[model samples]
Target: MAKKKYDYSPNDFVVYPAHGVGKVVSIETQEIAGFELEMFVIAFEKDKMTLRVPTNKAEEVGMRSLASTDVVADCMKTLRGKAKVKKAMWSRRAQEYEQKINSGDLIAIAEVVRDLHRADDQREQSYSERQLYEAALERLTREFAAVGNGNELEAGTEITDTLQSRVSAA
Candidate 1:
């Protein structure tokens, strides 16, 4: 038997670039086209989606373990920083934000949330802006929760608290 390229085991939390976070439900080997293909069966409970990614292609597809404590701390620091909203067109900026959210990079996702965040006193976000902000927030929250071994709501509250504090301090 060939050794697995990745060390992901069942029930491990992993981030798939385009899909945020998912749990490795199982490692499966399925016969396909006269070859045995080993794959990771990942489940995104929140999205109600299950995805099978080839084990050998996990790295190629940007699948990785959850962020470390230091990375999470850096992400929080990113949230505390100023929002760097570009003066580009809405469509262009929206596309960029979407790409960042889907990149599965914790810091990039934090930047999207920070850039699109609207405080209570600030002008309201447009429909599209709200959508992108919510998506980024959700992705960040889920990973944060997984990293802390906490619930999503708690993680989300902590994240928002950090953002709100930054706003109040500025």
Candidate 2:
């Protein structure tokens, strides 16, 4: 197999679609049917799970390096923007939110975070809504923390506080 043009290092953090953030633990080679296949071994600490993705298939699988500083800035800007909650039924909106979270696109995840966030005086979210909100919040916060050099709880609190402030100001 040709060497990957851009190979991930062991300590590098990556975003894997459907799995959020994970660290590249190492690369391994296995012989299958007389062919040596190289794989990227990624560890998702939060989920206590490991994933092996072929190096050549990384892009195809939507495995990517962390969001760049500019993209992260855009995501933060997205959080401060006005929420665009449609008047559609809850089920449809929930499905859309789930898709956004799983897309591993920073801005899309921020959109989910923005729309589901509740201000102090707003009505409490339903159980399912709350679940989706938390899931999106966790996904967003994990990336934020990874990039910001902070822990998940700290990053979560900061983002959430800013979100609440933005919602109330609107």
Candidate 3:
């Protein structure tokens, strides 16, 4: 058998679109339906969940390595930009926000966070709005933390500080 090439190796952090940041624990070959298949075993520490993804299907499932520093910088710039709240109905907006969070694009997730965020003095978000905001914030911070070599709490503080500064300046 020829050696197989894989994009990720053991102990590497990866981002799964629907999930967030997870570590690739190992790659294993297993027999299913009498055929051997190689899979990537990923462990999501925060969620306390483990996922096995077929090696060939990882990219198709939107599993990717963490963002680069340049991408993280772009996400910060996006957070500082003005929020583009639409005039659509709340349900529609919420659906859009959920999609952005699950898209696993750092910039798109940052946009969702920026758009949904309310300043301390601003009106309080509705229960659903608050839920969406928190979801987006978590996804963004997790990836940010992984890329920046910091914990999620530090990343959350840095991100919120950026938002706060932007609000104050405005």
Candidate 4:
């Protein structure tokens, strides 16, 4: 695998696709499968989880630093834009939504959240839909929290409200 080109180092805050934000605790060389591998051990304090990403595969796995304020601003703006709800079958739309959430692109994740969000007056969502929505919401909120230097609850509320208000207005 080719080396990743990143401006970040150990102890940096980065967003891992599908997993949310984590801090690079250390860069270690470990012997795995009879070969020495250089990897970054990232700790997700919020989820009490850790990830070891091979240095070369970090980019391929969507490991990236927190977006700059301007970038984050644009992502949040995406939430308020028109929801491109497709008129496809539920299964088809569900798969597409899952892919967007897992892609770990904040803007794409925000779109999923915005599209699935139903306001207080809207009909109740199915259990599966709720699960998917919650997953996408949590994923987006964690990254937003890291970027805003806030806690999970705070970040979640902000993103949810922003998205909900937009969808409600539609």
Residue 75, candidate 1: alpha-carbon lDDT: 95
- Tell me which of candidates 2 and 3 scores higher on TM-score: 3
List model 1 lDDT by residue over 1-170, tens digit each.
Answer: 67655679999999999999899999999999999999999999989999999998999989999999999999999999999988999999999999998888999999999999999999988999999999999999999999997699999999999999999999
Q: By lDDT, who's the top model here?
A: 1
Global fold similarity of model 2 (TM-score): 0.92
TM-score of each: 0.96, 0.92, 0.97, 0.89
lDDT of 2 at 93: 91
Please tell me which predicted candidate would have the highest TM-score against the true structure: 3
Better of 1 and 4 by TM-score: 1
lDDT tens readout by residue for model 3, 1-170: 79787999999999999999999999999999998999999999989999999999999999999999999999999999998999999999999999989998889999999999999899989999999999999999999999887688999999999999999999
lDDT of 2 by residue, 1-170 (tens): 56555568889999998999999999998787998888899999989999999888999989888888798889888999999999999999999999999999989999998999888788999999889888888888999899888498888988888797797788
Q: What TM-score would you give candidate 1 relative to the actual structure? A: 0.96
Residue 92 in candidate 2 has what lDDT? 96
Q: Once superposed on the true structure, which residue ranges of model 2 sit more than 4 Å away at CA?
A: 1-5
User: If candidate 2 were superposed on the true structure by all CA atoms, what would the RMSD be?
Assistant: 1.9
Model 4 lDDT per residue over 64-133, tens place: 8887888778878888887788999989999999999888788888888878887888789988888889
Where does candidate 4 have its weakest 10-residue lDDT segment? Answer: 2-11
Order of the predicted models by lDDT, top scorer first: 1, 3, 2, 4
Global local distance difference test of model 4: 0.84
Q: What lDDT is reached at residue 10 by model 3?
A: 96
